[model samples]
Target: MTDDRRRRGLEMMRQVYGWEVGDAPGDFFGITVDHLFADIWSRPGLSMRDRRLLLLGVLAARGLNDVLDIQIPAALANSELTAAELREIAIFLTHYVGWPLGARLSVQIDTLIAEHERKRH
Candidate 1:
């Protein structure tokens, strides 16, 4: 059963991040995979995109641009969000999260979009 959960979690990690994932390396990552991904992320209540949007809001509000660096690209690669949609999200977040973080998000979005396009071409 634990193995099954780990396998499901690895798959969920790949699906969520749009990247290849491997077995967890440590206790922290084990929990992240075996529980966070397998159980929480696999829950049926929300679509992946919806969960991502919620996560983005929380990350932005907390000024966690570094995490956004990972999430925005994954969101783009997964087709869960468009560049324009990201820009709009940044704009909307400005009202609630303040201008600095919003600006950071906007800039990060632009950078990630360019990077994604470059990698594709």
Candidate 2:
């Protein structure tokens, strides 16, 4: 049923992003929840951490720092990655993604790590 799928999608979204689902209006949101989260993200074989690492690489490669802003924090909250691991990811990715984008990702990672540390302490 549609409602069941929506519910599943919402739960998946929360699991993936640490986000609380609300009534978001729009076809795009509908598809994102119903299809992307429910169908795609909920599929088996890959762990959430694996999917996140792949996504992080894509986001970093494309220099999508805005999206990374959301993902990196979710990754931390989800315990999918640590601050040191994230920094290492940035460094490793820099060799492939090039310096400018790597720097951008590094800066974002550093900022988020500092924020996470501040919250913890």
Candidate 3:
């Protein structure tokens, strides 16, 4: 259970996404410990696209809009989703979660998208 692979994944998550799996609160600590991270994320069985689908649900369930703001672009960069696809998801989520939330999320997504374009230049 405790191994270098687990440690590496935890560290990489911290450096890349600022996800501190070690200092996680009681909420996430027991829910998704190193075992789950190693078993699921490290597995090659599912494609990144499928992984994003699951992550989206998790995000929505937790009402973590800010995190998803960052995540949508990441999903695109990882080839898990396209810009158009993300737009569609936003549209659909808006209907379900209310426009106010969607609007806020859209603003964040737009910033990320613009930053991405600028970085390419």
Candidate 2's displacement at residue 36, Å, is 0.5
Instruction: Give per-residue CA lDDT, model 1, range 1-121, as digits (tens).
Output: 3999999999999999999998947899999999899999999999999999999999999999889999999999999999899889999998999999889888988999999989989
Q: How much is 27 displaced in model 1, in angstroms?
A: 1.3
The TM-score measured for candidate 3 stands at 0.66
Q: Ranking under lDDT, best-scoring first?
A: 1, 2, 3
* Structural RMSD, model 2: 1.0
Candidate 1, residue 49: how far the Cα is off, in Å: 0.3
lDDT at position 66, candidate 3? 76
Note the Cα lDDT for every prediction shown.
Answer: 0.93, 0.93, 0.64
Between candidates 2 and 3, name the one with more favorable TM-score: 2
* Candidate 3 local Cα displacement, residue 67, angstroms: 1.5
- Candidate 3 achieves a global lDDT of 0.64
